[model samples]
Target chain A: MDSGKTTKEILKAKLAEGEPTPLYNPEALAKIKDNFAVWKETVVQEKDRKNWEVTPKTILGSDIPRSLLYTPIDNENLDYAKDLGFSGQEPFTRGLHANMYRGRTWTLRQLSAAGSPAEVNNRLKMLLERGATGTNLALDLATVQMFDSDEPESMGQVGTVGVPIDCVEDMEAIYKDIPIDQISASIVTHYPRNTSIIFPMYLVMAERRGIPWDKLPGSVQNDFIMESVVRSASEYIPPRDDFRVQCDNIEFIRKYVPRWNFITLNGYNLREWGTSGITEMAVAIANGVEILKDMGKRGYDPDWVGERLAFFWSPANDFFEEVARLRAVRRLWYRIMKYRFNCKNPRSMWSKCHVQTSGVSLMREEPMANVTRSAYHAMAAALGGAQSLHVDGYDEAFSIPSDVANLLALRTQQILEAETQITQVVDPLAGSFYVEALTNKIEALILDEIDEIEKMGGLVDVVDSGWLHNKASRYIQREQKMIEDGTIKIVARNYFRDPNLEMPEIWVKEYDPALAKAMMDKLARVRSQRNNEKADNTIKALIDACKKGGNVMAACVECARADVTVGEMRRAFVKAFGLWKTPIYA
Target chain B: MASKKKIRVLLAQFPLETHSRGIIAVAGMLRDAGMEVILMGNALPKQIVETAVQEYVDVIGISTYCGGELALGGDLMKAAEERGIKKRTSFLIGGIFPPKDIPKLKNIGFDGTFLSATKEEIVSCIQSAVAAKN
Candidate 1:
């Protein structure tokens, strides 16, 4: 399709579809066209702003504006069926599910944790009882990520941030009496222990409870894209070796636990680090493609693997901008699946995601104002058609959420789901001329960023060269300067003064002496009772798998069988893989 | 006309949780008051103590939006006390400080608590903390 012929042909299609094409209205088209033409002319005709001449302003992913200015003329050629398709159709830009929210509302997954497993269990029940669809578990930093509750490096840390789970017994004690199969449980753990300690503990619970394996519905977000992005360059593990470990899990999960979602591409963290929406989308799609490509070469079919794929994205403070982002993600993913991968299944084309509101946008000033901030962002996510949503607690800017603060955060989502009547339909913002235009603009911008990253050798390259980190640091610097200089006025922050309203108080969960004593005693008993021979053999097997480039999850399962703690598995990896050292910024 | 003595405050925007909004605003407030506010973004407790010692400021403030404050705060204060630095500096906390345990923080050696202090209140609190320390 030549430019001239394509324009004319697209115009005819638009008019036939009962739409106003920019070409038909010559005067209006000339205005927009002329503006662009003049912009190009001026760029070519004039000297640059700085020391030298002939420069074009570059749009770093961060330099791209948060919200694009779009118009109806932008979508003149958009076909409802081809472009903005139905909720459950090819290129599902609208939604993934057939009925969408009309069938059921998105899961209200609140981030919850406490000092002890029992406390977290109580909190989980409280959130579930208050209309939360799933339990979002945040593990204690020492226990979950590093794997040792009593490591000197982990001093002064306990269940304050998340529940402390030291053994299979702790996991069992935490979920005692709760129907695990009935509800979805979401856990956030990214250490070596996930394959070894965590995954098997849950399997054991399922097997013991007589629950069918297919009935287990939950999300395990194990992403290694960042290992290439953040760790590989630091020589934490040789790039090839990291790939081996990641591919091992993907292969293991593919064959077993067909119903479970193994890896959720966590583009949300990248977005939180100040990457632009387009960069986020570009990296996300590229990351997913990399994982799929590697797995396919390993003989796993894309058809089976795509069903297990999911995404997690951050919904920023820009309300309509976020809606446009989600729309662009769905549209672009559908295209990639259809054209790039040649996957025939519609589910392969589906883009399902979970959104957590922008933590950067929350203000410490008038901390109560965050309630309103989260409420609006939650609405944006709802309108954007998120599969699951977590609204930041109003007190999130302060400490761990007091019970009242956490309850209020839950209520924020409840109000949207129950009182607002916004959940009555799926794709609530569909058919908006402005929204469609924004979606197209976002799609274009994302493609440009993806192209730039591809040129740099993809997401892994950008991460290794410290380019992504530099980009984030530069963006954060600009935002900080703006907020500091009062260029962007934050209410109760740089602007208005409210001195009299006392900050609301929160109740911090304390370390329970009884629980700690019970844990220590339990730890001692497990140490004495578990078969030492079995544990030693499993550790050796895990190490051998690493050296042989074999699937580690199988060895991980054996480790769990021997009651090897999460900490022990972590130590084994550290011994072999080494710790990730971040770049030192001077 | 006598110029007001600058509070010379150091603000640590620690990510106890994921939220940075509160510290960003509070830092701005302190800066507006002619205080030399240093932003230590997402530092661990040890790094925070090291920064506090290096900066040699009149006051040290830490913010946590994540629920790790109690554990973070207790260790931070303990570190300060061990260094014999607790008496010389005033520590103020912002973000979601539960009111029920304000006494606990006080007992742990935080001079005053800003449960969710606005920028203005935060600045004022810094001024008073600096004065009390002097």
Candidate 2:
């Protein structure tokens, strides 16, 4: 754990007592290669003559080619101590912990939210009672986009997708009678601007509940990627300003909320926006690097900031590719932290992640099949050594999950944890020739992409210049074309044309028509009863802080105490910094 | 032999609705099919109809992912009706919607409702709808 030891030095120290030799010697590798060549010409050629090809030419859902079979010849160049180190050690490519899931099971966190705040609260309690170990909060579009529920622009969309949080009162209602201090929560504030505005309300609610800030353990998706690259909004703050605000949120959270993860580098939404898995990690890593450099400039310790940095990934249909990408990113991150940033803490080197099954992979046709698809995706996440997981509901392709669908999604994770013995060993797929080779290939590709992004002037420049938009557009179009031409086969969608399949009786969550009026009335009550002068003064201070390039989160916490609404804080930001047209729409 | 006029289409979504992959792909397909595609980024129902009328588009397509399909779609149809362009403009709705809600969209005068549709299906549907209108 010395801060000055290089990876090579650490490897030498770890292996000095008994240096391990390669399992396959040169003669053994040559013999395997010769036998493989002979088998290819004899048995494989014979099978090829009969057109009995069984193995796929490429990995599913990706362009990476795969061989018919793999052996020790594939991983002959892999170094055990450096490339595939022991779990819980330097260059952690296998698993974060030596015991892996045997020591502690991955957190079963379901992303549940819909209807009013009280309704979402009830659903959260129900999920906890049904066996979810953690809570992942999904905010309504109105709340996420920084509009109050009663605003004209928020009409008909108040509580449709997730919970509507207008003020601290809404936050209190959402976590009413729930011990947030005990159970961790993930507030999906998503973009930096919203995080600055909305996360303060959560802190204020915690304060009101007499829970200290350090005692509250949770994460916020305060990612600039959501604002710059994956966002579909037509308007945005400039990427540079958003990045600054992102660093501001990090600085404030690291100082005040010690146990809280200030930012979850959000690759999940980016992948769901139609990029490949390689681009997803590369983009997120590039963003993380930018934030680290900014915080370093602000004179913060890399190890201190790096330990709390976490990632959120979307596990898509490519099972092996997803698992390999996870392993590859962990190793790549360890190298980045150790060599590039010179961080010596093993915790700082750990690439902790929470994965959500890809919502885009689920199909609306024969929705029940989505259950199977998500289960497979969740299993891949577990095999990839995720710290937490969220299985997309079978009915999410249509709307927010119905109660039955939510329960089923939670049960999917529970079944995997209890019934399957897959988690008994650490990194069960570590020694596979195919997996190791794939991990190396993916790691190299991601590093190359990161280098390309750096050459293009980092993430902010690429986004501002519309290069990221063009890349995403091309990927989206190509994916849709493949699905259309049957190159990528989805069960009932493009592959097996089933015309007579009976549609199951799916219960979709209905939108509450009365929600708009009720929210409007509640806002009216809050406005009429609160101290208007205090709220106005806090709003002025927040706007001043925004204009002065100061930490806006502190001012936002003050605003939250004054009961300032989400929309009010957002308007103040817009008033101070204005808005930039998103390059995609521009 | 005279050249046929290219079909003009306008695709719009609500400002708060943040799912654009479907609409962007559909726009690309329509453009490739020799149709003039106008992307109205994040507009209200009234603004969408006004832009459709101003652009003289033959079709108006609304892509909604986050909820509020009924309210927004109904308002869009009403706006078009008020402008007296319902018959001239073929209206279509696409994106994630419950199967039961398809009838409601049709009831609101949406000429077509597509869910999980292929590019070929969307292009041909728009072609036929515009051809019928002509």
Candidate 3:
């Protein structure tokens, strides 16, 4: 059976047999261009005079044009096995699981957060009671920055944007009565150093309740690159050490919490912060490479780290482009994981993602219209084969979604899941003439952006040089100008101006006067009731371990159970490592 | 032609509000429209009002979102009044809010406010507010 031909040559010969006729014709495309030039002189010129300033182009966030028509003039080169394999197969451009939602529908991971543990707990319970398959919680600014609620810097910020957690008790109370083993719970935080502290609290709390570590399901949004790129840089320690703590969690979780997806590299923040779809995809990938490079230096296996990571992305208003973006990300992630990172595991190469519809696309005026926009983006996510999806509330542009709005947003997803036959098939849009072409275009743009960053010495160096921030800020400003110039028409702004624009009555969550008192009093009680001697000793040991450049998770777990506050852990960090200075560009 | 003294404006967002992109874009647009814009990045209300007094700017723009802290805007006016800059400077608020909140914001001494206003709307507001102050 041994042949003279090499395995590579054998594969080449097998693939060379009977290729389909090219699906495109250059002569036909050229003929269209010639006709388009004439139409531009006559029909388009007449239209341009009236609409030129309204929108510079009918384009997707990837900068792909919206032509008057699409007829696949150059899609002849699409190979099925090469470009897209079947769901759950090699080079998984379709879906991660073979069954997709057919096995189980996409998880409705509605994000619920507020000031106090009890308050957020109520919201989470409500979400689960109302049919949410998973729940995500956003920590307040104080907790995100590693501050205790009683700190002066945390004044008036306790439990504002997300839930507030000051001590182990707060974490316990946040999940009180909700069985952690049953429902998927995700804690959305920026810095991994914070995750280093917060995850220990979750693990210790789960352990105390008799739940096995592997049984606790969900992810921690512990990506630090986007924190530097889009979020306030002041919120994190410098990239190098922030990533150090990120790997610490990776090493610990691989050994202990094997079932938990420890990292959700969040490009949703960047996209919501104003970068386009291609940039978001590239930046998220670049962020992962940077983290893996750091982990490699520390001797963590690339495949082990890659397999455990997940992604969070936001698709904007472009329907087909959003669908194409989801497809392109899977293909791009596969190439990166296998070729660049040397990942052999098929699961390691799969890009499992949780998608959120863009909140920035929501309009404040005539807020009800946002419901329609959200439905379209949700349809795109379903058509794009998201593993899980969170549809934005119609009232998100103003405040956190009210009870009514939150319910309606969840209902939107339910209707799509139940009413439509979307989840019945994997990669529903695959093999389409327009969708396939757009997917290729997006994949090309992502590589181009990645190449540009690689030329700049990668993400960490570009951020160190302040280039990433400048690009994001400038793009957002330019987009604003476009909207103002009547080029990018926003609904109810430049496009639809309702004559009777009566502001609809919306239920606003009143700022609880007692919420701050409640948070501070809890922190005070924990500080007093804990074994002060053990707490102090544990904190000291944790800081010393960090200074010694050891994996601090074990010590962190020890300190967490001893009831050391987030403030103490953070204070120890700043004492050992000075604050990072963010590069400022005018 | 004498270089006219550019209309000076000061802007800031509430402390801990990382939604600074909106204010940053507004600051850039205002500067591009030929006004001298001073951006005080996320700061406390007192720090913002104090900067307005110290800088002697023509307008004080405060960005409030994430539940649109209406009370914080009122506190800002009170702080500005204590510093004796409330009457001298025009106060404005910008955020995503219901149209119903505009009158309340005005009642709290905000000469004007923007609920996702256009660049043209923002620039014109800055121009007219400065002209009125003069």
Best by DockQ: 2
Q: Show model 1 residue runs off by greater than 4 Å.
A: A1-70, A122-133, A190-196, A210-212, A225-244, A400-403, A406-411, A418-428, A499-502, B1-134
lDDT of 2 by residue, A1-586 (tens): 2244433334334434554567668898899899988887787766564553232221124466676676888888667887888887878999899888999999877777788888889988987887666778989898888998887678878888888899999999999988998888889999999999999999999999999998989899999889877877746788888888899999999999999999999989988886888889989998988888889889998899999999999998878888999999999888888766778788998889999999988887789899999999999999999999989899978777787887899889989999998988889899899899899889878878887888777789998888888888777777766676667778887668698765454665556879878888999999999999999999999999999977999999999999999999989988888898776531
Candidate 2 vs candidate 3: which has greater TM-score? 2
TM-score of 3: 0.88
Error of 2 at A328 (Å): 0.8
Candidate 1, residue A435: Cα displacement in angstroms equals 1.4
Error of 2 at B59 (Å): 1.5
Q: Per-residue alpha-carbon lDDT of model 3 for B1-134, expressed as tens digits?
A: 13378878887777666776787788778888888888776666788888888888989888766543576676788898899887779887887555677788789888878776667788777777767766
DockQ comparison, 2 vs 3, better candidate: 2
Which TM-score value belongs to model 2? 0.93
True contacts kept of each: 0.21, 0.63, 0.31
Model 3 C-alpha RMSD to native: 5.4
Specify the highest-lDDT model's number. Answer: 2
Is model 2 an incorrect, acceptable, medium or high docking prediction?
Answer: medium
Poorest lDDT segment (10 consecutive residues) of candidate 1 chain A: A52-61
Query: On residues A142-256, what C-alpha lDDT tens digit does candidate 1 reach at each position?
Result: 5645445554434444565777777677777677777778788777755323544577777666766788767877767666654434211212443445555666776776677
iRMS per model in Å? 6.4, 2.3, 3.0
Over all chains combined, what TM-score does candidate 1 have?
Answer: 0.78
Query: In model 3, what is the error at residue A218, expressed in angstroms?
Result: 1.5
